[model samples]
Target: MRRVQRVPLDEAARQYLCERQQYARRLLAEDRLRAARFWKDMRETAVFTPVLTALEQMAGPRRRCMYCLDSRGSDVEHFRPKASYPHRMCSWRNLLLCCSDCGRKKGDRFPLDDQGLPLLLDPSADEPWEHLDFDPETGNLTPRFDPTGASSPRGEETVRMLELDQREELALGYQTTYKRLKRELEVALSAGPLDPSALRERLEEADDHGLLPWCLRYGGSTLAPFSTLRQEHPAVWAALSEAV
Candidate 1:
């Protein structure tokens, strides 16, 4: 998963969500809220359309799942499980775009660190590469090892909860995108430097799985083509890195 900037809901949508959340809060306080039923009722109505629309917009043109970045994000997922945190049921900050597979895997299973902070990496809120590492050969995602050789707890939980290392199709998609990114850089390096703007655009177009930051800033930067680019064209490398 990659870090994504959260798109703010427009005034009208924002107000609607606030009002609905207030209503949910009231229900929860009165002990009358049934999490599934309440969300289902709201979900089927025209009032919830804007929330879904904003999530799709946040997911970009392909509307890929915020968790896996592989399949179409067709479901509205709650960052905190609605059953456990009913007060946040309609809160704008709680919703996420999710695919069927991810939704199924993550069904209401929210893990938190000892201090109550979330253990699952929220792509919109966290830089995934800080906690997660990608394996190019195996096409799997694993917890990032720190300088002390300890794996990231959040990454470990995220990968386990979402089955990131076990899914064949997801691995294939990541590998495909990684290969495409490598090819683009290799071709650009061989043909002599292109304008930084043009190189950035080309790389962005090829980065379907949101792997650019990993390729440019994380461990992949130490790899062959990227390291070559960094040495041979410091200006171009710096520009592309800053853009991502």
Candidate 2:
């Protein structure tokens, strides 16, 4: 998963949103129409744009959910439930671009810390790899161990809330992407003295969810072909890692 930069709303769109947020709040008080209109506007502007871009940027070019690092993201997810936090309904940082499968599984459940900060890291606001880790051989996602080596709290919650480790399709998707990345690296290595910039661009273009960052920054360094590159060609590995 990655952090996505939110699109700045134009004056017109911005004003419209402010007005609508109030309108929805009023309607919500009466328990009618607000949900529909909110959904309507959300769909119309397609909240996915900024949300997706943020995910792309933060996640490295491999655009999987920050939580699962699987599934090709297809929806803008709300880190905090919009219904519960109307105050942040139009807040860009509160949104996440995720797959429908993750969205459905995560529906409206906002797990929080004792102090009330969200347990799930905001992909847009934080570097998820800091709180999470990937298991390459098995392709399972889990919390990153801390300096003392215990699983990270945020990572554990993110995994449970999004069901990252349990989703069959998500696991399969990550597995496929991982294999493809490995295969590509092997081909590049065979070519000898690979151009890191050119290869990075090529990989970025090929990535479906703009997931090149994760590959270069995290997945590439830890996994095969990538591991081979790191072991056999430090300069190339450094170049690729630095590019992200």
TM-score of each: 0.97, 0.77
- Poorest stretch of ten by lDDT in candidate 2: 46-55
Q: Of the candidates shown, which would achieve the greatest TM-score relative to the real structure?
A: 1
- Candidate 2 clash total? 19
Residue-wise C-alpha lDDT for candidate 2, range 1-244, written one tens digit per residue: 6555554555565665567667777877787745535765765775434444554555555566644556666676667778778666766556566767778888888888889888887766777777767666556666778669688789899888877677666666666666766677788889877888877766655554324455666644666667788889888778877765
RMSD of each: 1.0, 4.2
Scanning candidate 1 in windows of ten residues, the lowest lDDT window is: 189-198
Cα-based lDDT for every prediction: 0.90, 0.67
The candidate that achieves the highest lDDT relative to the unseen native structure: 1
